[model samples]
Target chain A: MIALYTALITGAIMAGLQAASAAPPGGEFPSKVPVPADNPMTPRKIHLGKQLYFDPRLSLSGDVSCDTCHNVAGNGSDGLPLSFGVLGRVDRPRHAPTVFNSAFNTVQFWDGRAKSLEDQAKGPLLNPIEMGMPSSGAIVKRLAGIPGYRREFARVFGGKTPITFEHVVQAIATYERTLVTPDSPYDRYLKGDKNALDKSAKQGMHEVSDLGCASCHAGAMFDNPGLPMGTGWFRKFPMIPTNPTCATYVREYHLADDPGRFDVTHKQSDEHVFKVPSLRNVAVLAPYFQNGSVGSLRTAVRVMAACQLGKTLTGLQTTNIVAFLNSLTGKFPVETMPHLPETPDSTSMMQVAKLQQNQRQLN
Target chain B: MIALYTALITGAIMAGLQAASAAPPGGEFPSKVPVPADNPMTPRKIHLGKQLYFDPRLSLSGDVSCDTCHNVAGNGSDGLPLSFGVLGRVDRPRHAPTVFNSAFNTVQFWDGRAKSLEDQAKGPLLNPIEMGMPSSGAIVKRLAGIPGYRREFARVFGGKTPITFEHVVQAIATYERTLVTPDSPYDRYLKGDKNALDKSAKQGMHEVSDLGCASCHAGAMFDNPGLPMGTGWFRKFPMIPTNPTCATYVREYHLADDPGRFDVTHKQSDEHVFKVPSLRNVAVLAPYFQNGSVGSLRTAVRVMAACQLGKTLTGLQTTNIVAFLNSLTGKFPVETMPHLPETPDSTSMMQVAKLQQNQRQLN
Candidate 1:
């Protein structure tokens, strides 16, 4: 497909082909989202997952849902620098990453701690500050008591007592799988449409490719380049930390505050190593980097150029790259609000929350 | 329409008609919502309202939108008893009423402090424990900074400075005017469908109407009986506090704890007085009453019967009434998630929140 697309392109723009060829050539977004064989994608399961994703009852305070942070209403990530958890009780350290097209990521989470969307799904629910559901058994009991969910779980999974924590994550992962964004402007350009991007954006695309930005941000997703699942495409954020200009950004943004993948692996080599992030929707996703310290896309581009490539981009170069990044914004699918099911007689969501606490104590 | 539907019914059920005649006759939910003449409804305005309704930027925490509490996805009310404010720092005393069909109420809020939906819209934006926008000017300034919202407001309202506090409420109220729940089973029955309700529910319907529940829970909306806007249909909960059965409920649920209308009006007669709430989706709205003391619909019905009507209903009566209330569950319109407008370049929602705080302090 790449060869065919390349054949269609005029040779006049082949100045950066040598550099792009050394890196992986961009590919089209897959029409179908990849799903694990263990958790096959069924429409009912997806529907159930949508309900669960929107249902705030899963949280300790019963107000924060997956949509509360990674809201699908706009860019998947909430526009806030940091997302607040249940009842807005505690602040999460990192910005909640955009869930849009997250299924395509080889590993989930900024640290690449969770191998897949399923693993990522469970992390927040049990996380003390995020969803905060105490124990897995408590989640099962809490959901099972909701008459609407109980019936749904039975219908979807087709077994008695089907509302298990495993199925909960499974269903959510299935739903997240459907959140792929396709037909971005850059994609159209790669598909042989010369006019897809603005003149500046086209120049920026060539500039980035020639600068070897594609070496890390490769393939269609721009994060993982044909890496197997569980094999993280990890890269050190400040690749050229010794560079004078890079050291300035490192301090200003508190880039080294987090140990990154080292927090999970507990290894010196993994220090400051993080999953290569997708550039899709980066235009609207402001307050860039893991810590959400930077504010503008233009500034982020400049910072990245300095910190990673050890080259301070000129004003025109930064503008061009920003234009290029803006073209990655794609058409987001319409999110329809699902009718979440009702809890059993008279047991307010508050009581259920207390029940979770009690169950946690027992466990 | 009521007379026509009444004629369709057999004369066999005239036993309770005499008692019901003293109260308001049941009517079908109106196809249209009442809008103040001053604030006309428009599609563009409604669309803008939807964006604002879901935008968390209105809050001090920049995470609590109108939809955060009075969620329209399910019962319109969050299943929790009390809603938390910014950062979950404080708990609101009263239950956040369902926004569905709220436009039909003659007065807004449990205490009837706000005269109309437009007035109600303004209350939460600046309330320290709610949306927490500092002042009216701050709200205008906060919204004006967003480039997309600036464009949208200009298009919708058509002025150089279109993003005003008044216009914000106008758009939100206009959008809220569409949140009526119709085509309920009870509504179908009111439209002359004989089999719309089950036998038990039918019996329960007659029981409530004859028992004088209609005096307050009247008209198409079941909360205002042809009353002029701003004329609250206020009623004292636990009306006959002297009755032995009523005293038990009043004591157990702390029914008289709140000063209610007295809090707003400071009148002797207004003690424990509250605007009559609609029973439209009461089945799904658990943790009932102003304080959410009663958990189940059945228990709430029993409590209401005892406190308001001064009658200790039998289990069968409670069951029947609960079933009847369940039949009022209407077909909720599909809430389409609107693409909330993006904030300008690098301003994280967090920064906007801080601006609101500074504006508050300045005010």
Candidate 2:
């Protein structure tokens, strides 16, 4: 029995390796960032964004920030299925995805709701349950009231009355672009250092291609297959749900709980179709899928095989796929936590009427 | 009328300056940290503690870390009346104090319940409403399961079964000791750079002395007049609450809400008694007082004078004191955000029985 298992695994590894060698593998992440012509990257703007990203003053509760949900400090995720928002509201619809390498995505968010990173930045701040600002104007007003922020906006953006909702999102998205992590072991292996991956990981890397996982998770980001920016390469999760294995897993995890992209587009064809989430750093960002129902990466791998590909994975296959996914974990950039700029001796909370702010916002 | 007001202000400044000039001024923060003999400072332990500080896995909700409430990136205090804890519990009775310079604090917490920083570190993580670990054993179990944390703990605290709750707090407290912010404009002034503080700030400094604010807010930290470490300087918040003005203000702000130290000590004398909190970075830490009732620093200063000293200040006194407090806002040290350690292909959340963790924890 042991000899039969080893022979089958070896045959699978050889077949997978043959498929991987058919192409030059043009999935290397672009070293140069594609800057929006209107908004060039600047040190001052990045610095401004860092402060705004960490500042809770953006939230109505003054407890949540951009970092609260999409925390760049960790794996760019808060690790919860749905992050708690202002006043501790835990009704956030989806698991917060990692902000790392979000720039490489053709579109931001699971549903591909926002076309660009800048548009995605504004959604949570006004989401009532998320950052919970009443309106974009209210957020802008709070930023403008602070003299330091006002000066920073003017300096970074360089215009009369520059502390706009537009500028805030631009700065934040620009800062987020700097959050991409590179230099994973997978990249080293791709760069011709064969010894970068131990035996099992190499087998898993080839199996990922053989199992058709790379069709969606294609490229250095594992998000797109040479698509233009804003053109999301989306695919239906649980693509082969009619298969008995797929149907059984779907019913168990409630894979149909969310309508996915159908909610965004209100199109029947878009139902259950979600953006191909980057497999980069997927090992650390567990509790997988749209609903974050899956916790272990191995289970996610097994579920993907049975539900999406309609193949029941053997124990060896499951272990190997998990190993390859683990190789996606990359070196994170060191970031200095910012000292959020404060108005001297006063705060935006103080600007509100006396006991009303305490009643409305505080405990 | 203007001349008369100016003359009075000049006289007050001169009197305050006379009091300040009388002493050698022993309030400058000590340049070196006084490490406890048992938990000597090391780069490795500090590094380990930092990972623990930023890791949300320590929290039952997998959201709140040490940095969530006491965010070192901003003013150590989360600028809210009470910080929202794990699962967004906002029932925290008192405002979270700034973690900056907390090492110099005689005792931790508003009521001085914890005797040392190490003792205080364990409080929030286990508090049902705060970080909300089920128990110390559960937290230790969670940490031990993470291989990266296990290796780090073993390296930092050299013994078998190194991942103890005790060592966790020790490392955190040791890291907290390094959180001290030293060179503010006030510190620079104390270092004989008279010009570091502008003219208005200088006048405010002197008035702080004249108003007897220096009596309690004494020395470099403005916490105590040389109390030995571990001995808290307790004082009645509304020292002269019987004063009609003080009584009226108290009723409006609900200053008598929580029976401060009495809850811990259960002694009549300890009723409404709180540790004299350090005024190190008081300028940025707004929404002042125990309940965070007063939003403006001017209002807080006025309330302190009326409630504590039975003195009503002129407008100029409030403005000048606010300026002086602004000078206390110190230079924050740069901190790099950490990548929390993740187990190879598993997580503590996964170890919990399947869908039960999702039911208990996530949305």
- How high is the lDDT of residue B188 in model 2? 78
Residues B307-327, candidate 1: write the lDDT tens digits.
788888988888888888888
The segments of candidate 1 whose C-alpha lies over 4 angstroms from its true place after superposition are: A1-25, A352-363, B1-25, B352-363
Using alpha carbons, what is the TM-score of model 2?
Answer: 0.90
In model 2, which regions exceed 4 Å deviation?
A1-20, A24-26, A343-347, A350-363, B1-20, B24-26, B343-347, B350-363
Candidate 1 local Cα displacement, residue A128, angstroms: 1.1
Residue A145, model 1, lDDT: 75
DockQ of each: 0.39, 0.33
Evaluated at residue B42, the lDDT of candidate 2 is: 93
Models 1 onward score TM values of 0.91, 0.90
For model 2, which pairs clash? Answer: B27-B219, B27-B220
Error of 2 at B316 (Å): 2.2
lDDT per residue, candidate 1, A1-363, as tens digits? 011122212222332453444321355665666667788889999999999998998887788889888888867887776677764544434777899989878789999998888989999899867888889988887897788987899999987668888999999998988887888897787666869999899778877777778778876777766666666899998888888888888887777777899999999999989899988888888768887777778878877888888888888988888888888888898888888988747463656435333322421
Instruction: Identify the leading candidate in terms of lDDT.
Output: 1
Instruction: Write down the lDDT that model 1 would get.
Output: 0.77
